[model samples]
Target: MLIRSFDVLPAIDILDGRAVRLSGGKREAPTLDGGDPLRLAGRYAAEGARRLHLVDLDGAFSGVPRPELVRDVAAAAGIPVQVGGGYRTLEAIEAALAAGAQRVMVGTAALSATFVRRAVERFGDALVVAVDVRDGRVAVDGWTHTSELGPGELARRCAELGVVRLLVTSAARDGSLAGPDLPLLREVLPAGLPVLAAGGIASLADLRAVRDAGCEGAIVGSALLAGRFTLAEALATATG
Candidate 1:
């Protein structure tokens, strides 16, 4: 098998303008505080992060995005950023891109084929559909609602709609550090679409597993924040 080049995107999840990680995608769950979003972005960039995964946790729950914060982090990180949360419309998506995001991830909106087709037509490769899974079903509305669509079904839909990539997140494993849901990756990878795995990435070994599962990249959160490993170590493991 040909080993594909993999990317390790350090995640900076923002809540109320501060960096935080919500356990298991729960809005009210206890958060792991990661001080000063811009500072963290800069630090990650300095530590050799190729790209940053920025999430507006506040916007995700409230349906109000903070594009200015995205702008600030992107400017501070001085690297490519893929931002998500509350981007349900073309205008909202445009705001994030205008703010400095190289790519914008849409969740609930992606459930609509019309929206997916239009988003792909408008943004092309800049649009990424977030296929957040919970109990084998696609979760949406900031992961508060579970849909009937499965991960594989959603992946196939996005691929058919011309979505450039899918960000597959295991809501149950997110921030738990139990380990990645490789089985979930396997379910979606068969769609023959580019995928970026998120949630429960605990160690370098977990990163390797994600790579071996054929993910285009991995979005790591809690582990990196808890000092489980350095960003340099993650990048090295992903590249090798």
Candidate 2:
């Protein structure tokens, strides 16, 4: 995609290594996880998606990484898997890598700069830091952990800690299929870095909007997974 020089990273979230939808990115959504996540991952990869976003909803709720399931999806996907959700320990992070995750996203760990640096220094730039903002404040632990940290400060902290990319998702907009908050992106985004703007993306036009606002990509869940839009078509639209 000629999207202001930003790459669009398509999403493939897994609750139980199966395709499922979450309401507001919360676990309360009606489960449609009848299909295997491995198959879904392969589908996305076959569709020309370079990176895949997978979430361990069960693990997130349990405070542990489901190594077996994560490994299964990674092995099957044949592409880089950026896995996240419910990862809070060094052992968990290491296990995720050992399971073949190219990149591991940390939400709760992002709050502590030391932990982020530890993962980054050990794992390098592929280690992504997540900034899940609700009402402009950062939240973690499946959106249960609330913090007073502002987006700009958190982005700066993550950037300073050797994290190459910061993922900014609006909790309010998540899974609403409305759209991303561009004004917030423009205001809180740090210069000279890539911001993965996620949540509430419902159409190709929304992708263009995020690209126009200087976001590298978007994290689309409900819409894309439900077949409201196809990844290949979205890519064609974004790249077109």
Give per-candidate clash totals. 0, 1
Residue runs of model 2 more than 4 Å from their true location after superposition: 1-4, 31-34
Can you list the residue pairs that collide in candidate 2? 1-239
lDDT of 1 by residue, 137-227 (tens): 9999899999999999999998888887999999999999999999999999888888999999999999999998889999998999999
Once superposed on the true structure, which residue ranges of model 1 sit more than 4 Å away at CA? Answer: 1-3
**Which clashing pairs does model 1 show?**
none
lDDT of 2 by residue, 67-184 (tens): 8877888888888888888888778888998998888888887788778877887888668788788877888778866788888888877766677877888877776777778876
- As for model 1, its CA RMSD to the true structure in angstroms is 1.1
Number of the predicted model whose TM-score against the real structure is largest: 1
Worst lDDT run of 10 residues, candidate 1, spans 1-10
TM-score of each: 0.98, 0.91
- lDDT values, one for every candidate: 0.92, 0.77
Task: For candidate 2, give the lDDT of residue 9.
Answer: 69
